[model samples]
Target: MKWSEISIHTTQEAVEPISNILHEAGASGVVIEDPEDLVKERTSVYGEIYQLDPNDYPEEGVIVKAYLPVTSFLGETVEEIKVGINNLITYDIDLGHNRVSISEVNEEEWATAWKKYYKPVKISEKITITPTWEDYEPVSSDEVIIELDPGMAFGTGTHPTTVMCLQAIEKYITQGDHVIDVGTGSGVLSIAAAQLGAANVEAFDLDEVAVTSARLNVKLNKVASTVTVGQNNLLEGIEGPVDVIVGNLLAEIILLFVPDAARVLKKDGYFITSGIIQGKKNDVKQSLLQAGFEIVETLEMEDWVAIIAKNSADTKEG
Candidate 1:
């Protein structure tokens, strides 16, 4: 078998959305090569091992790589991916160079090569995400391990937005609480909510591929019975009164559904929003305020932000 590696040279801010585009186009595996990783500090407390080669990364911007099988429809798929990425500009996302390239490789070589970049890294006080191929044991009695196979998913569940969202979920979710995960890519948050003792979880994604990948991951993490994966736009047709609502999506998308989020959440329930850039922090905060949510806490990681807001009892349902 042969695989074609599609590489996109773009900005760090564009990585998540561009990766989503590739995943939607039937990419088998996605790998991100950010130049920042070369000089970024890693703490041993989190058990992160950094063995990155500078040569593998671009001098500027970020390079996102994905593997697709060489097929008759390969060219059309690539063109569609390009169009999808270009469409992102309307959202005010920075694309940087936005150059794309492709190369062919042997299946055996490509399958195992990208695995070296992923290792068990503790993302929070209680949660550590490890690749499915790695054998990792919990170092403490309270530690929780999430095993993910990124080859079939959108991300490795270790991005800053995801980490902050998971940490917020761990902090707020109560035992047997009902949680709803909006834009539930890879179903990581839904799985975590269940693992943390949530009685039930509703996970949703707009992309059918993401819905499929997330369901696969929920089963892989052995939480399928507790977490339900489906396809739906953010907060649309969801009648909650759920204990918690979490979304890790672009700030613009988050803004679009703030009122719906407020309506579905139980009074005093938490809304955890991530994938927001630092500059857009104030905008999200204001939206949450208008939607009758009181800002509870704000979390920052690098240039990304995650906000935890509480839906007030006074919030009116339209």
Candidate 2:
């Protein structure tokens, strides 16, 4: 079978939404090529060598690629995707170059096309994200290694938003903390918390695919004993009162759960939120403040923001 390669030149903020649009349009999977990776310094600490080519990335913004079977309705599907992408602007999402391109390739080519774009990288000082197919070794005694296979789910454990959440986890998670990972795509954050010695961790995602993928990743990380993956909308019905709550979700979705997060979060508990575009940074911060959270710190990478806050509700369940 042949496939049409649909590639969008867009902003980091629009990557998730556009990727969703493509998925809904019947794309088998999506590949993201962000220019930031070109300059990312990777280590061969495990003696595994991989090289990245600059031409594979756009000079600015990012290129999101997806594969759709070449069919009679291919044109209609592309049009629908275009319309969906354009509609995002009404919601205040930046489209960057707003360029879309299409190409044709065989199924075999499409299968291996994305592999060249993914590689192991040291996302944080102590954390390294290596793809499941790669061989890597710890460079230091304190290094944390995450083996991930994104598998059409969102979290690669290297995206800026996810990376920020992992970094926050390493710093704020107590040795025996009970943690909740909201919208835990691929369960990367949950697995990270579990590996970090979290006594218990709950991974929640509304998408069934994400739930299954997260469960597999959690097991792959050998943290099934500590981390549990489930499907749930936001923080609804989450009986938390936990030490740490983290969500890497869109700013709008994050706003919807701020109040709920504050409700379940124990007094002095930590809240880490990411997947926020730079433009919506303040809106999310204000929402958190309104929900009885004190802003601890804000981290920025590329064009994304991650906010760490502390629940100041003054009510401890225990």
Candidate 3:
């Protein structure tokens, strides 16, 4: 099928609002290019580990895109969307590709497409990730557990954020801790937490794909009974006090949700956060402090930092 690929370019500041504008302007759906996801997920694992220079990357803006069929009855549809988008977003909007062909793809092919991209990933002496297509034999002495075919979503223990979260879980999580993994993309951190002796792991993300992917990952890891994955925002839909909260998201979102997290965490509960750029470390620290938490330790790896902190008793005293 032929699709009119309407791609709009905007500044980082305007990406979200412009996306909303584009949706109002009558498009099918918008695809926002979040470079932060790639920076936090892909680059830290595959790209340079300890020395990520964000400036070396693009100014890091999203492409708000939607599709219109060639046979659509809307005349000057692109122009209408463009003008409405321009009014909402003060930035210039470059209409990228007009028409691109799309084909119906099957689930098997789509899931296995990453096979060529994925190889046997050895994160630590304890955990090794092997794609489903490949038959990998592990030496008996390695003491390595296998995560067979992490399907598709994110997180295969290969991304830096996932690696960092797993390492943090392995290090700090105690037995019988109720763990909440907000933005549980592919349920990597939650599953890791469950495996690491978290009593119960409740995981959620905004993306349905992420929820499905997370469930698949949990099943792949055989932690389905321990970890629960769903589509929800950071601790908002979840009730009760969790002992530990692990969020592998951009630093800004972490700061925004820390207060709620503080509310949902039991007194002295730990909040382990990663996906923070080196430059944003101090900001996150200050935000956590302001959110009524004490920074217990900051783990630095590959130019990124994961902060482990405990909630203060006086969080609600204000």
Best by lDDT: 1
Local accuracy of candidate 2 as per-residue lDDT tens digits, 104-124: 999888777677767787766
Candidate 1: lDDT of 258? 96
lDDT of 1 by residue, 125-189 (tens): 89888888888889899888898877655332277898889889999999999999999988889
Which runs of model 3 end up more than 4 angstroms from their true locations?
Answer: 1-113, 138-150, 154-157, 314-318
TM-score ranking of the models? 1, 2, 3
Alpha-carbon RMSD to native, per candidate: 2.2, 3.3, 7.9
Q: Model 2, stretches more than 4 Å misplaced? A: 23-26, 40-50, 69-80, 153-157, 315-318
TM-score of 3: 0.64
Clash counts for all predictions: 0, 0, 2
Model 2: how far residue 257 lies from native, Å: 0.7
